[model samples]
Target chain A: MSSNTDFVLSIEDLTVSFDGFKAVDKLNLYVDKNEIRVVIGPNGAGKTTVLDLICGKTRATSGSIKFKDLELTRMSEHQIVRAGVGRKFQNPSIYENLTVFENLEISYPKGRSVFGALAFKRTAEVVARVEEIAREIMLDEFLGTEAGLLSHGQKQWLEIGMLLIQDPELLMLDEPVAGMSARERELTGQLLRRICTNRSVLVIEHDMEFVKNIAHKVTVLHQGKILKEGSMEMVQSDPKVIEVYLGH
Target chain B: MQVAMNKLFGGREGLVGLAILAALIFIIMPLTFDIFRLNLVGKYLTYAFVAIGLVLCWGYGGILSLGQGMFFGLGGYCMAMFLKLESSSPESTKIQSTPGIPDFMDWNQLTALPWFWEPFHSLSFSLVAVIAVPCIFAFIISVAMFKRRVGGVYFAIITQAIALILTILIIGQQGYTGGINGITDLRTLKGWDIRTDEAKYVLYFLNGALLIGCILVGRLIITSKLGRLLLAMRDREDRVRFSGYDVSSFKVFVFCVGAMMSAIGGAMFTLQVGFMSPSFVGIVPSIEMVIFAAVGGRMSLIGAVYGALIVNFAKTFFSESFPALWLFLMGGLFIAVVMLFPNGLAGIYTSYIKPRIDAWIQGRRGGGNLTPTVPAEPQDPVSPRTAERTPASAASRSLAAGIQSEPSRS
Candidate 1:
């Protein structure tokens, strides 16, 4: 119950049930500052549910999700975002109708309120920030392109760039490389490592090669409980993890 | 200065579109139409206010409200109440059992004016009520529904039900609301006879000016960051929410703005038409208002105005000649517009007419030059076949090339 914690996010006894069916049951997970933790498991392993709990998407039935010093369970989605937590959906969720620059500008962490957005001026500072994030995601030249027109991989990158603009303290991604080609996967790995320098990242992935390249640590989930948690090599070698997840 | 103007009015093209619409409403229509026709056009323009609001709400925000007529009715009734009270002075109603109350109240055996109607005696209060009452009502409805994440067809259905409820309530309260006939026989507005020809002309111009002003306000919102946000939210509501926006608040705000605009139109309707009725505040008229927006091109402000004017004109024309088949014709027209031109008249203009006009202008310039001019191909180096690709895909393919050329990480 201490207010102080070295970890960026701490979850203890987190449980979310849908009509008495517990999706995430008594899960205890901790993500440290500037760490990239990957959660990998079978289809119904509750990997997404854990991220949902952290970002206030799905309310927890019983538990505490402490993001820094704040209790995330009580806050709304936007409030959770403003408190410096960013989430990317399983599917690339960029605004298709908006241009790349606008997609980034909309997520620039300023003018977030209704009236603020109304009076928001597209100042040089905002343009510069948008350009910076666009270049980081390798989308600098495609600033004027509509987001919907981007290839699957580029759309994923744009979503990442959107979260990057917010500069959130804790970043969560669900299947960042689900539909990506090999080259797109490699570029995404490099992008993830580069962006994780100053923030904590929680990524859900089924691609072992991509996970090995970017994950600092790995947590294996089985039926809403963690079966193994360690370095990539450690989790990969764990007999229980191998039996429940990787063995198949 | 030029850049600022472009930003305010959605670029030079938008400004030109607006100017053309202004010329039609202010100069051409007034000059060509007789007083009777002009007054009718003014009435149609009042509905345009509701249509314009729908562009912001349903078109941009993706919130389709089928109860705009309720807000419009609220405004019209407010204005009508004021006028009716003015004309129903003690001298005018001396033969009635009660000399000071509205005639409808006297017939229903009510002694004094209802407490709510007492404020309508003050023109300023009634004028404010015309906008504020509908907005407050909209705020409540939107907060209750949007906060619960009730939207799309459910929201539309709920609004239709609310409009129906309001119509029934007005009809049931014959004493207070002047019954099904509505608040009619409105004679004056603060001693100025609104029924006079000069008053009608002034009211028409005022309605036109106010509509133009509303369009300008809408343009301002549409061109701002908020406008982009509305478009973004419409397509991807969760994306906007995750990006740190209170999505419901934006929905509520736009819905209120739409309500306020509809109320203004309703007030103008009362003034020009000299009455208010439940027929204009129910489900059918509300759907008709939505048709105006859809036919005009829901996304285009000026198009909605033209939509209202054109549809109403068609109605008048057809109803006059083919009175029995007018309803069938309207239904058929709506179906055709949806099937053939989903983007409505504005969409047709932009997709077909505007391009041809641009090409013709280019050809004229080319003809004047000594050298033969070739049409410029899209500047997409990545895709040589971009000349055949749609502009949207060409831009995206160029982006695909950018990603393909990225250096692979070791």
Candidate 2:
């Protein structure tokens, strides 16, 4: 189905199966520009798999994932990222060996080619951008901190800052606040809202309160299929969504 | 611009590494040993090429290719082919049944030169092939494996298999490849007799210079963003790929660069040793090359040269005096190096020697008080091998060397 031009990411009839079992079955979803969408489901309901499929980490057995005019199913992970899409892993995947500043700098989008990377310089513009993202993610003070030394909440924020550094048009994060303290979850909710002002944010989270606080719209998946799609209140009110996901 | 270049050249660790290598090549070995022994040191430096390349591919890129000797052999064979062709000139080999063909080819009852050996008639072609062949081979292997998402042990296994295949192919095609004896008895390079003592000294210095050049190239790659990308890619492959870098392409490029480095070493080895044989091309030598990188800090390119020379020197020293115990000693050295100091000799220097050296330099400058900005991490204690050696005015700016030297400490 052709979603409106405002929708930056649209999936049509996406299906992927491992051996005889289908992980994602005929899933269709779309998110508009600057809209923060969250997909929530019980475990094994293919919540994370959707992000994987969108990011080209998991190959779609058969489907079309269109980011604007581009068909992402055919592209590789790096190509998809270059095409203005960024995905964060469920676990914080920040570089522990490098400092927070270096981690953010590496993820910045200006230089990806081998030669480009060799000649890359850290200009004032880049430093200002990294600092700005760090401030947004509340990691500005920890710029010199080795990422491995960061608290679990700071590491999670740092990962978000890394994605922000790339400034992807459509950012996808899986379980952004799964292990955060209550204060961290609150700050992350606000951070997601602030970052989504210019682009799209797709989050997969189990923390209902955090998801409700941030998501403009919610999609519920059950058995690799969309079970409900509506505003957070409407989705929560649905008996089927409540039975499969929210009731837990 | 100045700061970036300093880090790129290995800064303090690099300065220390360069200083040590210079001492070994130009000063210590030259002064202590006669020309004969110095030439032997030249022989060990060739492997330093392979080891330094390993620092790029295995240590930094994290691709443990157990087939570096394949590239080295190919490069050496190219040079050997050129030398062999020159030595087997129509005038020199008039006694042979085929006047123009190499002696080994003639001995194997070949009436005509093999089609593959036809290109060796041009020294230019042989020279190009020395770098091109190994790089092309590495490109093929890396593209096939890395593109397919095959790495770690599987990639290592495949590379080892490639080494096996090459050795078998070279040996089995005895007529074409000079058999297990390999391309040997190489004499002159275009009428310049390589066997002369004068030529030996020239080749030795040339080899040392090329080794330094390769170290600089390694420094260039590792210090640049591409180098940091290699470190990031190794630690978090998906993160890098997701960061919009083509991970496989980076892998292929570094692998090719490493292969090219080894080929130069091989060409130099052919020049210095006067022969290229299967002894240097087989699975054992291939694995032995990895030990050179490991015995040096795999992450430290300068450490790699020292690693290669030290290991080879020890090998020669032990095998000469206690021939029966040499193998056991090598085995123990490798095991002990791996178990006790996984970071190798460079690790010891950085952790212990470099810090003390830094303190001595700093203590002299600022009356017994090390700067507070330094020692952010107690474990990574070292700096300014450059500043220590050079005058304070130019060297003061090189404390950036501390960060560069500290890259692999973690």
Candidate 3:
């Protein structure tokens, strides 16, 4: 992705500290429209903190976070979402008491009017959309199952589908495949590729192989700062990346 | 057909219908029986309305309010005070002669009704007063408390203090308030004779209608996006805050709604019992309301109604029959239910009754399989700071990814 490409989000000098411990420091990055950007880091390298800051989960200590020219640092998480940024927390947050289909329905931006959730009849389009998302995530068969009953990976997929239904312009996922089986991980990778076809995706993952599989560009974070930002090969060849992962 | 029927009769609709049915029986059975039975059922329906509010506040919203009785009392006293005034003629009556005044007010020798008591003379004013007073009180207190970010035990204690203060204030103002005997000798509602069976029936029907309206409103709100936000408030309040919801606003909304419902219940109680006193609006009544919901099931709306009816029925039964042991039995029952069925009577019935009924129809009945499954015990307590990082690891490895949410930091 070139600098001239329409960027969905730009983070400049983003600094977030917890109790004097700097978790994210002066980070600058931009996610180009319809591009897949992977953020890789060792534990405590502030990858999740970046996503958290973008989604308004954590207030940036000092920073400029712009999504399509709208300032996101001052907005609430839901407002950020409404402003077209969707996030999938590392751990699934689907309503357990609700059915799988109901979970997806709640996340649909247009389908959440007070009357709509309780009394609104599911249109054929809604049914089709839900089924389509479920089918893509291999969850079509489990539509009737309670979301509480889904496997770990399936829950993650359902959550991702939820974000998709919201139709956010930028999707930020934190360790989306953290606990998935190999098969489920591969499916998630494919799902990310499909999602990246339309909207910008900033994925934070610890797994280098997973990053290499889905990343169009990889940014390596070490000690709360971006150490490297380049193609997968370039980032993999970076000495800091090897030192953080293997040596120091 | 099966699914449709199941949906209709298996969930909230079914419970609400049952509540309406109980209300109907209360209204009609009085005609079939004597006024004594009529009054009893009428009073029960009033309590049922109170329980419905408790359901929303405690059961779903996860706020175990111990001050609902204060709100209830606010409404009750509003009505009772008005009724006392209406009953009192300009010329001193015989009841006023007792202790040289109405018994509770004898000490004060109150020659004139207080300025606050003047408007309550009209039935409409008193009726509106019942709902409004409690709501305003709740609105003010909740705003103060929630703004300071008080929650959990502190919230519960502050509410308890409010109830206590109101109770004491009412008790001390015997001249203005009815005090210990509260306000009794209520004869009519406005121009209509409350002694009439039709009058009692109207009150009963209104109670039923109000309950239904409340349930519907609660249903609409809880099932909406706001409901999700409320539930999220219970699970991850900070997350919800960061999600951009004004947490204080949501808390106040729930508190006001709960207070209004209790006030409505109190108004009904005054009409049914023809009296209201400080005792009814104290800590004991508040705790009883909580117990009613807890015994039914804290997480389920229908369970609150069931718990209210069952617990109240037991109170009526045991108090009359085994007076000395009634409290003992109530305590025992609470302990037993908490230990045996942490989810409460609803869970017990689900595990025990429904299965047995199904088995009997299938001709493979077994009553022994009724032990309720205990909800997973609270995960070993983790400090808030540690708790934050634990979700990353705990969720990274779990059989039940969806069920085991990290206990929220309040």
Candidate 4:
């Protein structure tokens, strides 16, 4: 009955269906400010769908998603993004045809409108910001490198850098370390921990070891619903979580 | 100063390309061809306007519109209607039943001018309609399709279908649209006889100047942040959307720009060719216009102009000599260009010729002080042979080099 305004993101009984099957069903989640919440699930647990529902990539059949008291359910994807909810896709989705600097500049959150983009100048402020983000993502040297030529790990970082430039209040990263090398995965964990200090981060990750390193709290999703939620140690030890997901 | 100039054009390569194109259109072609041949070249240059537009829409924005001819036809018809009305004055058409109406309308037994055609009596209104009509139509189509997220092959088919529908409508409405023959016998423009050799020369120069202006405008767009966003959106629409952009609005804007450009070409066509017809407003001509963009290197504005000139010149050459083989040859050229040099002439230049020229230039510089020029090389890490396969990357590599080198300078 009572909704919490203190939380950065509050999702109450969110449900989404395709045909007759519910991909995300009656899910209630709340993310606190400056918290790193990791969602772990086996295949078909609707972890990605939960992110989609929040980012407005998929419409919910019922329930509400509130970001800082703003109803994200009624907004379009871009509007939701502009409202400070940034989503990174499962794959590394950088613009291959552009340079790394351009990839970062495109996501700088300025000149987003049609006319704005046309009139957008590469001001020193913009260039300085782009350079800062590129450095944070460990891609300062590759500014002129064609994004398509980057390694899989670099591309993933570039996508994260893209989201960082927007500086979204609530960040949703879908499998940030998937297909990454062990070194890359560790660096990503460090990157995640550093970046989440200023804003809430909702990560959908499958790797348990990586999850332990970055998760302030862990939520186990099973069949469109949360099976367990607690600290990483608590969720790892939960029998239901083990049987449904971690056991595999 | 050099950086500012590079920014104004695409880069040094872009400036050279523009200069070469200007020479061909303004100096070489004018000096070589007689008025009749030059008029035909001017007509082809009008199509260059449409091709340049396609470079932005289809090449950069990644929205393939196969119905450019419809906009071109609309623009040409607007100009034609004004010319037709001017030529159809009471004294000129006194023998017809309706002394002040177009001959085709009078022949079809129409007693008065259609309400739609009434505004064409004013030169200013017709001139505005030449761009406005097609842009409004393009805006509607882009919004309807792009808002629904329909794209790629489906979008192309829908545009082609619209072109066909417009052609059929023009043909069926014999009374209103001059039927399949279109609005013809255009004699004067503001009481100036446009059929004279002097008028032809003036119109040819005007069309050339306009095409160059359009290319410059296209260059401005391609070098802007918007152009980079278009490239980004084409590759990753979701990424751009999540970056807080209304993707459909950009698509609609570029499509409308493309439509406006095609309309200008059409109006110029009517002025230069002395007619506007359904043949140039249908599916075949629409696809042909796309080929012009494709063959010219869809990614290159200057290349599109050259593409229009090359393809149309071949069409005239083949059709004049071996009329039966022209169609087959045209098809073969399209196939060969797509398969071999996918980036068109611009691709060939960037991938093969430009690099060789660059290497020679470097060689001539005695390989000393390679550091300044080496910045351009790192942007394109791939070998020239590999770059040849993905010509767009090679073209954009230089573009990126120009852009990346800016912050350092400042």
| Cα RMSD, each candidate | 4.3, 4.8, 8.2, 4.4
Query: What DockQ does model 1 achieve?
Result: 0.56
lDDT of 4 by residue, A33-140 (tens): 999999999999899989988888889999999998899999999999999999999999999767787889889988989889988877789889998998999988
| Residue B235 lDDT in candidate 2 | 86
**For residues B179-237, what per-residue lDDT tens digits would candidate 1 score against the true structure?**
99898898998899999899999999999999999999998888777888998899899
DockQ, cand. 2: 0.52
DockQ for each numbered candidate: 0.56, 0.52, 0.12, 0.57
TM-score of 3: 0.81
Candidate 1 per-residue lDDT, tens place, A75-107, comes to 999999999999999999988766787789889
Model 4 CAPRI quality: medium
Model 2, stretches more than 4 Å misplaced? A1-4, B370-375, B378-410
Q: Rank the candidates by DockQ, best first.
A: 4, 1, 2, 3
Off by over 4 Å in 1: A1-4, B368-410
Instruction: Give the per-residue lDDT digits (tens) of candidate 4, residues B1-410.
Output: 65456656656667787788889889999999999999999999999999999999999999999999999999999999999999999999999988999999999999989999999999999999999999999999999999999999999999999999999999999999999899999999999999999999999999999998898888778777788888888989999998999999999999999999999999999999999999999998998999999999989888898899999999998899999998888889899999998889988877667666776788788765454433245444342111211225546465555555433210
Q: What order do you get sorting by TM-score, best first?
A: 4, 1, 2, 3
Give the worst 10-residue stretch by lDDT in candidate 2 chain B: B388-397
| Candidate 3 lDDT by residue in tens digits, A1-248 | 12223578888888998999999998889888888998887888888888888887788999788898788999866678778888888888776655567667556565333234345444577777887888877787777555666778888998888888767789888889998889889989998998777788999898778888999998888889999999999887878788886345
Sort candidate 1 into its docking category: medium
Q: Which residue ranges in model 4 land beyond 4 Å of their true spot?
A: B1-4, B367-376, B379-410
Measured by DockQ, the strongest candidate is 4
